[model samples]
Target: MQECDPDHLVLAIENGEFERASEILARDCQNRCVCSVSALQVTALQVAAWQGRIDLLDRLYEKGAGVNDVDKIGRCALYYAAHRGNVDVTEWLLQRGGYVDAKIGVYSCTKGIPYTSLTKACFVGRKLPLPVCWGRTPLHQAVKNNHADVVRALVEHGADVNAKDERLVTPLLLAGSATDRDDLKEMTKFVEIVKILVAAKAFVNIIHPDTGTTALHHAAMLGSAEATEILLSNGAWPMYKCKSSGSTPLHIVASTGSTETLMVLLEAMLPHNIDTRDQINRTALHRASYRGHRECVRALVEHGANLAATTKTGTTVVDAIFAHIPRPLAFITEILDSCVRTTNNSPLETYDNVLLAFGYLIVGFALSFAVLFHGNDQFRDFWRAVVRTVVMMMGEYEYEELFSAENGRGTFLPITSRIVFFAFIMLSSIVLINLMIGLAVNDIQGLEKEGHIRRLLKQAEFVAHLERVTSHRIFRGNWLHPRLRMLLHSRRDIPTKITLFSRENYFHHVNHLVESPSKIPADLVEALFLLATKTFHKNDNLTGKNIEIGDTKLTSILSNLEEQVRELKIHLSQFDESEIVETARIQNKACTKKTVNS
Candidate 1:
């Protein structure tokens, strides 16, 4: 085998000169040095196998090429053959001692994930389950690359259809979850692969232990109506919730805007399943509206969904739309000419006023008693003075007793007592009571005029909430750091909830690692809101044009109906004028005769 030049052999193989490629191999006994026959990274045998050059592969094998020869990673010749969809090459490779369970080259980096127990060193981390195969098998590569024939060949040769990768995603799940190019023909190919896997008895509801996605969930996510239908027909549970999001396939469909697939699921659903909520109590309607899927929202509503359904945080579908939909003022103002409205109907408003008045009355009474005690007092003690003071403040004082002049008592008290009492009367009884009255009256006057501003504030808060929900959804599905979501929401197990009212907590919640929730800088805020507003304006403009077209069609129909009504009235006039007049004349003559007799 060392007598054969590696460079010349590779050149012949590349140029597809199979005859010369085969002849370049030196005559070799069956027993030869193993490593010398193989090249550095990819052996010629593997290349020929991947290229589907069966004749060149046969020549290499006769020259002492090992069928089980692997690259630096554990990718065998069968792995390349399987990935390339060359079933005949895969069969030849496997028949010559290729192991089905050999790991593929794709996961070469993830091999031998050591079980480093930090718990043994300190006590924090955990013992993660390292996959023994380190990840992909030949079958996984075949299914991932859409080599359906290779998939069949391996499965028939006793490959594990249920083999799990590092994330516990199986070959069957991988097939359904192939990154869609959005081509219809590619979609059909995936559907066929799913059918093949299902015929092999692949488990339909095996959740990826990491992502918690099932085969059905993956198919739903793919948005292929036919693939979803096939999975459902094969006992895929549509209601199985993913552990990560606690969302069923129905929620996935609504979120993905897969209306056709949604219809397929809905037609097979029981009536009670229509309003199923996810973990956050967001119904499919809420999902559709939050994402601005107008048609999906309409379909959900037409199916008798509860439009007023609330999330766990107490927001309804209409609320979601109002809060999140950009340019909501224009849309809402059309139906509500006032744009926004508020109602201050709480009973507490009046109760607050009453409390304010009572508090001032107590303060006034206390001051009057304290002043009366500073000098001469008509009463025996401070308590007596306080009683008298209360009476004087309410305008029910006994004026005759203070001025009686009985037993050396004069018509007036000393100057100090008189001045103190009079000042108390002015400060407490007059000034303080009037102040409370003014405040109460002011509130009443303002409520009537401030409704519009209150409404605007309410609309702003609604829009902000919409922005928050949309951003949260994006982070959950975005390719960014999703762990940042923990800051937005409090965890039950964490102590963040304890500081809910603390200043530092409020500051951090609004300002830490993010723009302030309410007061982002104007330019940045505009940029953030611009995308939402543009989508809204585009959609609203389209909607307006559609409405105009419908209005034109409606006008033509109304004109036709008006002409028909006019023609029908003319026909009725021609039939009954003479007969109607004669009847009226007879009735008038009878009435005049009866009146004269009476």
Candidate 2:
């Protein structure tokens, strides 16, 4: 028998040549082994599946064509058919004893069956030479592409709606992935598909293997209020923080400034969740203020969000914004104002009081000088009286003037007059001067106690500026002319390369902008990947105390050290009297005792 080219038969099948496909299959030259000759899995049945050719599919199967054959990526003919939304062909294959969960060549030794159980345990997570399908069923493909009819057909044929792929991603979880929801329309389709899956009793809270994110997390990240509401109504727990982004649904909307979606999540979370913080101790209000979402800040404030909420650095939202915006948004004026109300004995207030005291001191000096100079002949000039009083206040007034007067003025001066003059000196030089010093010292002490709050307010103002500008670029501008790039140029908070817009306008030319890696530099990419995974451990000169090079645990350690220092400072601040001298004496005695013992 002449050898038959499987490519020709595949081409015939792809082009809808049912008779030619039948003729080629009937000849004994073609068989299941012959399908492997092509570069990809393009056997007669695989091509029929790709084109949804049910007639060619029936003939090929009858003539010994493999039904569950998979292509290069562990995807079978059933996968191809389901991916293409071929409901009839998928139904036909299902009825003809085809496996609904067929992965490419499952029974082959390449599937890792020959390994011992020990070896299996070791390499279960590691990939093999020929990878088995992540265990995704045909239903996974149908749900992914928004083919409701195909999904319904696959489900009715006993396909597992909750089938876990190798990554532990379920069909329902895959349905909610953001890779498909690129726009509002696409997001709506995903909601419809998810509704179908939920109707089929698909588990909603499956923690995905790659990110530990649940279905609600994905829906929230996708910015779909309807999908989020649907999941939440279906008893989906929205509180679980995704380990990948370190965020819940609330954090997602807050970061993106999705005001409407934010309202949806906020309504669901309600009174118990306004100040809920993430891994970094950043609340939704913190995220909103950091991004400058005034409307979100307003809503949170209305719900009585803790305006004093702090991040890991103990910085309030008002402080976070002061560095970014010249002035905070008008909506967050209340939060900014709370900066004055929140802190006690702040340095800024103390500095202001000290200035006011100096201003009042000038008036007091003028009045006292005019009164003392009133019944004297030579000291009648206001300027001369001011000069003499300033010298007397310093205890530098000359007594020689009373003893040697050229006009015989000292001979008639009374002793009782001297007593009255000395009384004025006591009040001006001793009493009021000491009182001024005491008040300034008191203000300085108050500043030492609460200076951190002023800085926090400044930081809050900086980040709040960013949030407001970002919201404006999205919500304020004309929809036909979305000024997305304006955010990058508006403030230096977000970098120039980053973008927040979900879609680009039709006329906007997105030049050589690499949205994704079209051509990956494999060696460099692999080297980078290895650099991240490679262990960087050594315990040499540091006395066997090691630290991960890129680990963030050091931040916590530093923060704890800062807190300890703060407590020590506070404890030491109370030692302002004779106790400090006593503490020094005790230290000296202890040193003497240690010296004697040595």
Candidate 3:
């Protein structure tokens, strides 16, 4: 009839005193509830499970210890068993109807027991609140600890392979997570675990709730070629984009500069996705170039990644490379030179034409000056006239010399000849010289504008080049299947339809295409406008109509629910606070009586 503390049973189990623990449980089974926990808030069953004492676990369970009773952290006995890799204890708990997929913070005591009264039960039914356990299942703990046997046991017992934690990360994602230390044995163990989970049909593409990354994303970030190959082989989508980073596995691997893992992912990646952009609108090649991963950039280029692809800020791959390494090595320069020549139309060529035009103007002026000053001895010879023209062009020749008799330049010249001199000076010095300078200045100003266009052209050229390569006879049998390859390589004459919801949406897209810092083609702008105009109705027609926010059915349902809430609030307002509390108290008593009767 005396009271006994739960710590006595917990200590008995901890000390491996099976007889004393059983005696306490047998006596406490009638006098006290085994669910009563110690100062640490851990039940005796949880201690026995953690200690892998199958005998004590059975005794505590038979004496009214809930198989799924939780500790302070809401971890149940099975969770501790799985955490400790106690296979026998886990199997015993599972046999006793323990929930295998029980998460850390969930209490299963009142689960599936509708008639059970919380007031009659012990601590577990109290609903003691705790923080998030990341929704981790017993399987997550087993996988995290690398207990392959326990993982197998949990899976064999119907553990949820796709059970996600609070982060929306699946057990498979946790198993494939990267670590800072690259222990071969540790990685090998995880790879085996991944194999087992995949064999059990785990969803490989489950995205992280926050990061929107999958198992492949983490594996790529890990730079593990073996793990990447396994995931890719098991239907992992290589081009699956992350919502947070908007990066594909290829993009993730590129940032790490793992050429081997990149190659593995690239093998699984579609050719069109090789230049896929991330959240910042930069491709894997851009990421590689920015990180100064020369080998990664080289590999990507060989795989047909676009070197001309620009970031959202108008930074080309070459620009990124130069920004990271101001002066790169010879091979990087060579690679750049080859692609730059193919894409870039240098201003130097136009400058050469301007220089040639200037030369012709000088020669033409010299011939005219020679004819105009023929009567003067100084300009009698054509070559001598050329020398004078050069000096005059430099602003060194004096106008007094042209009119002075002692200089013998133009003292005896006719009025027509003097007029010719004035015309020549104005045309050659002011008009022609300034025109040349103006052309050079205009070219410099056009460079920035031309850069955006040049990138577009280069991208076009790259696509065309890829089309030609893919369609080549050499790649006929060696590359993709004939039909799939033809489908991908075939040119489309018809444009795809794009829907613009509103006038703002339409203008936003048009402005995006026409923005000064990164201008696309005018034809592209025109095409977008034409497509929108033909596909959707005019804004004028849509002006008076109210835009729907959500699904009409959902909106109607929500409105009905709001009406119900208002009615409930009005009905509740009829009763005073004390009356409502008394009603709840009576209902609780009735439920407790029913539980006691059951």
User: Tens-digit lDDT track for model 1 on 442-495?
Assistant: 667777568878999999999777655644435555565556565444431122
| lDDT winner between candidates 1 and 2 | 1
Tens digits of per-residue lDDT for model 3 on 80-121? 887777888888988889899987754434343333333222
lDDT for predicted candidate 2 compared with the true structure: 0.64
| C-alpha lDDT of residue 330 in model 3 | 47
TM-score of each: 0.47, 0.48, 0.47
Off by over 4 Å in 2: 1-4, 11-42, 62-66, 69-74, 95-97, 104-106, 109-133, 178-182, 321-329, 334-598
- Judge candidate 3 against the unseen true structure and give its global Cα lDDT, from 0 to 1: 0.72
Off by over 4 Å in 3: 1-4, 11-33, 38-41, 53-66, 71-74, 85-88, 95-97, 104-131, 144-146, 164-169, 325-327, 333-598
lDDT string, candidate 2, 168-283, tens digits: 77888777543554666667668877787887888988888878788887777777788788888888877778887678878877776767777777777768777778888898
C-alpha lDDT score of every prediction, in listed order: 0.65, 0.64, 0.72
Rank list by lDDT: 3, 1, 2
Colliding residue pairs in candidate 3: 134-166
Quote the RMSD, in angstroms, for model 2. Answer: 28.8
lDDT accuracy of residue 210 in candidate 1: 75
Supply candidate 1's per-residue lDDT for 232.
Answer: 88
